[model samples]
Target: MLLALPPLYLKYFEDGYLLVPGFWTIFFFISALTLIVFVVVLTVQQKNNEMYAQAFLGATTFKLLACLIFVLIFIKKGRPEKLFFVADFMYLYFLNTVFEIYGLLRTLRNQNSK
Candidate 1:
């Protein structure tokens, strides 16, 4: 929820700068999906290091490709405010990437300590 505050505030109170229609719904859905993927990947990681590595790499690649497709579709059918979409997309993408990395590092640190 913390990740959503700025966007939510902007959308409702700040003249909706850097946002598109249905932005919150898309943001929340993506965030939830990413969280689910991370949890599943981490659970698998705990069972087998080899599979963990492969799963992690595979998940990352899949996410990148999916995001690319989403961007393409958005460009084709999205609103006229292209620049706002870019800003919103980057905000979600980079922050989610950071969270994913942090989760991976935390899990690794726990594994190492054990």
Candidate 2:
């Protein structure tokens, strides 16, 4: 998915500039963040599967807060590409979130079946 984003961005958003340095960096960052969240949730599920919802919520909150901070700092740095940055960021966030939820549900289902 991350690998495919660049073409989509180039095709759809000609002016889109994800994160400061480039799209690849931001993509990797978001991908890494998603992995961290997924791992943390998996750990929590192993310890107490019933806490999946809470764990997901907490991870989401943390991600949102981190994104907010990033946005604030980016804005402060005088990056005038708000629309491009925001659109790409939100797209990445949404995609990663859905992927996370799907993986969690699959894990839950597997555990329940056992």
Judging by lDDT against the true structure, name the best candidate: 1
Q: Estimate each model's TM-score.
A: 0.87, 0.78
For model 1, how does the per-residue alpha-carbon lDDT over 1-114 read when each residue is reduced to its tens digit? 678989878977998857877677568756876787698788888778769878888888887888788777767775647777777888888888788888898988898899
| lDDT: worst 10-residue window of model 1 | 71-80
For TM-score, the strongest prediction is: 1
lDDT of 2 at 94: 84
Candidate 2 displacement at residue 58 in angstroms: 0.9
| Clash tally for model 2 | 0
lDDT of 2 at 19: 41
Clashes of each: 0, 0
